[model samples]
Target: MEVLVNNKLYAVQQGITIAALLQFIQLSAHKGIAVAVNNQVVPKTAWDQQQVEPADNITIIRATQGG
Candidate 1:
């Protein structure tokens, strides 16, 4: 399956959940990241239940601390 991450296309295994995808990208769930799939924001509670399909557009945003 092919999914877009941060505007880049990546090949991932079938039946991959959003949580799994985050791990594959080497991103920590503790980073306070937000995810939107196909233009809809997915809540953290739904990450484990959300399955990503081929051609799905996934956008991940992380919060940064600055002064």
Candidate 2:
């Protein structure tokens, strides 16, 4: 299946969860991060339960240490 991630198209295996997607992208879950699917914010608790679909738009934001 293909999904739009941060405005870029990516091909991923079916039945992958948000948590897995993060891992696949080599993002650390320990860091504070935010995720939005189809323009709706998805809570961290739902990452494991949320399933990504083809053509789905996913946005991920992380807190940066800078002033």
Candidate 3:
């Protein structure tokens, strides 16, 4: 299946959870990361349980430590 990540299309396995996707993307340390699915923000506590649907719009943002 294909899902939109940060406005770009990326192929992913079916039934992939947000937590899995983050790991696949190599975000080993996601302390400052935030995710949204289909325009709705998903709390960090739900990443492991939130499954990505086909064509779902997923956005991931991470905080940087620069002023």
Judging by TM-score against the true structure, name the best candidate: 1
Give per-residue CA lDDT, model 1, range 1-67, as digits (tens).
8999989999999999999999999985646799999989999989989999999999999998899
Task: Provide backbone clash counts, one per model.
Answer: 0, 0, 0
Judge candidate 3 at residue 20 and give its lDDT: 95
Candidate 3 clash pair list: none
Sort by TM-score, best first: what order?
1, 2, 3
In angstroms, the error of model 2 at 35 is 0.2
Question: By summed lDDT, which 10 consecutive residues of candidate 1 come out lowest?
Answer: 23-32
Candidate 2 Cα errors over 4 Å, as ranges: none
In angstroms, the error of model 3 at 9 is 1.3
Model 2 per-residue lDDT tens digits across residues 1-67: 9999899888999999999999988885647799999999998999999999988999998888888
Q: For model 1, state the Cα shift of residue 57 in Å.
A: 0.6
The true-structure Cα RMSD of candidate 2 reads 1.0
Local lDDT at 26 for model 3: 84
- List clashing residue pairs in candidate 2: none
Could you tell me every candidate's TM-score relative to the true structure?
0.93, 0.92, 0.91
